[model samples]
Target: MAAAPSGPVGPNPPVIAVVGPTGSGKSDLAVHLALELDGEVINADAMQFYRGMDIGTAKISVAERRGVPHHLLDTMDVTEEASVSAFQADCRAAIRDIHSRGKRAILAGGSGLYVRAALDVLEFPGTDPAVRERLEREHAQAGLRPLQERLRSVDPVSADRLGDARRVIRALEVFELTGRPFSSFMPSREYFQPAVQIGLDVDRDVLRDRLAGRVHRMVDAGLLAEVARLDAAGLRRGKTASRALGYAQFLKVLDGESDTASAAEETIVATRQFARRQLTWFRADPRIHWLDWQDPDLVAKAAGICASPASVI
Candidate 1:
């Protein structure tokens, strides 16, 4: 086991967040930093919250965690929808508990919004079930075109930025319920607490290759079987989990709409696109310290940063 570094010279060491695109090795880096800093991890990956979403989400195995404590993984049922507001509260509580025990809290994962909700001074607009249901009905009746136009009229910025129907409908619902543009609640680059964000920088071509290999490995590792198990557990009814990259593609296979090989190919393509979006989201934040994902001494380099004064910012 690696020995942890000495206590921070400065008062109040900030929470450490390891964030980057999918397959950039954020989870492994989090474990390494935890071992060297007396830290526990708080998961920010939205999909990893589901109990049986292991292979597709690339969740760290028990052995891989290497005895480091992790919070928020496998905490939700497949049928449950994850709320960022709920996650923010849980994450803050976990961080406080970790700090009280004199341990660093390392927040890790690639879900850009979840990560921001956990570490930034952001608030989710309250939801109205009635408004949501109405919009959902409208979408079911006429599809995304009508809703997209409605959103573009009321909140053009959000509509332009959100390409997915779910997000667009939610934005419209927010506008209806709050009587304000959904983008008005957009968080500035302000931290909810003291924190340091470390981002993994990977070469685009290398990342694409890595992503394809990862999807292939997931298939060989029984991603389809995992999906079957979850599908039996009502995965199809789970709005969020059903839309996950590999899960979504594999679901089609299970539905007799496609085969494993074709589904795997689709998954690789979708995952690559998702990675690009992740990079775009994380790159917009100026506070992140980018380090090469392939660095030979990544753990040591990261540890040094955690021990330095910059770690508190």
Candidate 2:
């Protein structure tokens, strides 16, 4: 068990973020903390933002929320892209609203960047349509190698970091628009506001079993039906939502390229892989106070951390 990070120092209470890999019970723990602390939950999970994505996303149900208000969940249609910049604004606003009402703001999710965007001193560069279009055209005409070379010339760090053509193009576009390396815009650990992050640490073998069982349960809970319904609603047109873990695999089932059993297995594998990546991402953050996911005193420990006085920043 790591020592808890210092708590909030100013007039407002700290934004409490419960972070971990999927199937680590972050949602349930957040709800419990909210009940204990008189807080409202503001979702940091990007996938949970879309409406009708409940089953696949494992979104907390209304009854499960237990009358503690949850903000930002089900706020977007499946057709809309989940924008971190937009989410940063909305999440900050939600925090302010919760604070003004004298409630603690509890953020819960596995999406690392989204969690950071809400809590860190991150700036998003503006984009120009013409510049983006030109980059896209160049990528299409000459392939990713040429664009990769171009980006390598201007911003080698971003070039090395970004893998896909879309992100690489966006990196180039940012450099063209801002005359700055895309790496310069990357978030620092400095918080935008006072915040405390509590991470759920689960044993790797245990998490693997949990993720597999969760995927199977999701399939049994009509995940394929949910995907079919969303597919009918322009899901494939949406760049982000269409590629969600289970939704993507189940779409293969819908297209006759796979069976439900195969999709479920694939989803389980992909989800476990994603969980590993999530662990890697969160493990790098020293500020996160990690707790055993199965700790019987988890909520009590978390609330105590929240109550402790923080070092003045």
Residue-level lDDT of model 1, residues 1-313, one tens digit each, is 4665734624356889999999999999999999889889999999999999999999999999999999999999999988988999999999888888888999999999889888888979999888889889989999999899989899989988998888998899889888999998898889987888889999999999999999999999999999999999999999888899999999999999999999999999999999999999999998998899999988887877777775656
- The worst-scoring run of ten residues by lDDT in candidate 2 lies at 1-10
* Model 2 lDDT per residue over 1-313, tens place: 3433324433477888999999999999899888888789999999999999999999999999999999999998989988899999999999999988888899999999999999999999998989989998988888999999989999999998898988998899999999999999989899987788889999999889988899999988999999999999999988789989999999999999999999999999999999989999999988999999999999888878776765212
Stretches of candidate 1 off by over 4 Å are 1-12
RMSD of candidates 1 onward, in order: 1.6, 3.1
Which parts of model 2 are misplaced by more than 4 Å? 1-11, 311-313
The total of clashing pairs for model 2 equals: 0
TM for every model, in the order presented, reads 0.96, 0.94
Q: Tell me how far the alpha carbon of residue 252 in candidate 1 is from the true structure, in angstroms, after superposition.
A: 1.1
